[model samples]
Target: MLRSLVRALSGEVDPEIEARVRAVSQGVNELGFDKWGFSPDAVKHAMGLYAWLYREYFRVEAFGVEHVPPGRALLIGNHSSQLAYDGIMVATALLLEADPPRAVKAMIEKFFQHQPFVNVMMARSGQLTGLPQNALRLLQEDQLVMVFPEGARGGGKTVWERYELKRFGHGFMRLALEARAPIVPFGFIGGEEACPSLVDVKPLARLLGMPYLPITPTILPLPLPAKCSVYFGRPLVFDGRGDEEDAVIEGYVEEVRSSIGALIERGLSERRGIFFG
Candidate 1:
């Protein structure tokens, strides 16, 4: 097949190949291969890859995926743990849970766009710069958009700030209003557990040109084998109300923050599994 040929031609398997495979798989699954006489090989391959990564590296448990509807939806989740594993877990869960299996285009920080090969892989995987223009376009196309309003600082916060949702940016609300998309608030727990910080090394990080270096209780100080969970909240509808004002948008942002916080609390309190088990 052309896909196999393309994969063979590439000397090193890149993330873009995986992205294409995932997109094709999603399309096949949506088309109901059993009834349409189509093949789900790509989807199967992508799922297998994800399963292997998750099983080998992290234990992920997701709930409330049924909350994601078939339409333009904005997913706002708490970004904890310096590595941003929470975002990956949530995206994987959405891909696996949706009946038609929608492909989510995440809004990434501007810095990622400057990375050497990472930018290419992210673009091929449908990631876009966290700009208003791209957000509007995706919403207009009825694509699922995943955004972390707290940005990298929030996600990279120290262990002390774990589970504490930060002040959310208004961009998410504005995008929802512009695209008329329902907002889905979700929470990620145990991401910080994977990479807990033991000391404050901001000064050293500045010298090394790195953001922050977390000292965890590991031999090589890698991300701990923590049990990760993603909890999806009920959708918040726009109600056709034009952007009332900046004040109104701030109010809505607060509501979203509160909702996500509540979900995180619920997930953390109700979870019964260990990080490695």
Candidate 2:
């Protein structure tokens, strides 16, 4: 069981894998089990690695954790870094740095979810697609749901559009209205510099049916060591039926977007340097 969970989360392992497996397995056993396909052992192992990335490598400083209310809540943020490092950092902050240490169910892109190894690992880590049905169900169960409204567009951003937000989908807004979950907006600083997208080959991307293909300097499958900071804003709540008009719901979406945008600007200003915070 331990080996399986580790394999699902990480692609490779070595002699030290046994020690990690033992540690995570023990932690999972103490918690019993969960219904969301969440492998506590997998989460434990992943969190341990992310904690190091968040605390030491990037030297992250998280703020406004208190804004996340109890029960079901929507965590919306500006996504960048060419990868899901922004999402992982947000999850790490709440899991290891928050007052009560809450678990977040991140919404994964359907296209990316089809990858051979990523599929199982994402499910075992309790991440679900950003579908209305999935978000509603998770919120109904009183769980924290994190989403990047910008979706693939945000992840594929070029260097110039780093902090600039793209058009957001109304799906998250509708789900929040249906679940009556408050929205917690967050911003991640220094992520745009971590992997600057210099160019995107549109022809190749179209052939592959992907949004955009970003080409960056970091050739290796690793993010350059860069300092990071995260800021969570006050939660916002909207009273509306899920069937509301697009225009009406968009008003609320814009508000959340604006909040996150402001946080991003503030974080960028506060950052001391790119690699050193």
Candidate 3:
């Protein structure tokens, strides 16, 4: 009622704003207006918007999305760039290629949930709590769960540090083990180099409460025109192992890191032109 009244009083707001509002409302409905949540339809709609925005802003080419399996799987990929365009591209590619059109959910950082509007979009896009319980639930439902095991540091790592896989968190391995899901290792090239941030702006980031503000090279500094490739390696299956046992999960994590690293290296080496060219 209040929402309707607000909309009515606004007298036909901007289309983009309306769409975003509708997306948020849909998320509220699906999440039970609770602490945090997600909906497949809302996620698909949001992804569509992102794909449209990205295509208009930059030339994006994606490959190996066919490698994503139909059932439940954990997508562990290298995190690059302070911005999340890497994940966005991967999600878009999966949407375009997955048969039956699987809904891909990502375990996003907790900070994104702090913003009212940003949280709505993230939830609507099926980006649930990066918490263990939420992750376990999504995987059990047989959903494709995307995660940057390297977390915030890896995602925002400097360009020179791109493709250098950081020490990944073991939560993914635990979740995979608990849910019996396969770990799909993938990598994105050109994301870190797309909009490289040279220095740490801790004070500004703290002021805005944003993890990091990116400093890229394009007008509006969009992701570089250099071709972006998303390469997926064979899925790594997890045996039912005890979570307390570090050795088993460690071995699996190493494999995932190595797989992603190899793909990123190959993608970088195969590039036809320099990033700024």
Please provide, for model 2 over 1-277, each residue's C-alpha lDDT reduced to its tens digit, 9 standing for 90 to 100: 3454455347443334334433323234345445656776566666656766776777789989888988899999988778778888888787766656677899988877787888888887778877878889889988899999898888888888879999998888999898989999999887888778898777898899876788888873578878888999999999897889988998999999999999998998887888974
Model with the higher TM-score, candidate 2 or 3: 2
lDDT values for all models: 0.72, 0.80, 0.70
Q: Top lDDT: which candidate number?
A: 2
Which runs in model 2 stand beyond 4 Å of their true positions?
A: 1-33
What tens digits encode model 1's per-residue C-alpha lDDT throughout 11-41? 4344543454455443334544422232344
Task: Quickly count the clashes in candidate 1.
Answer: 1
- From the highest lDDT down, the ranking of the candidates is 2, 1, 3
Q: Which digits, one per residue and each the tens of the lDDT, describe model 3 over residues 1-277?
A: 3454444344444454334434333225543443345554455445445555444333455556666777789999988767677888787676554554555678888888897888888775667768988888877777789999999778667666767888999988888888888888888877776767676566787798877665545554355555466788888886775465788778878988888898888878777765431
Q: Which residue pairs collide, candidate 2? A: none
Cα displacement (Å) at residue 171, model 3: 0.8
List residue ranges in candidate 3 displaced over 4 A. Answer: 1-48, 53-58, 203-210, 213-222, 274-277
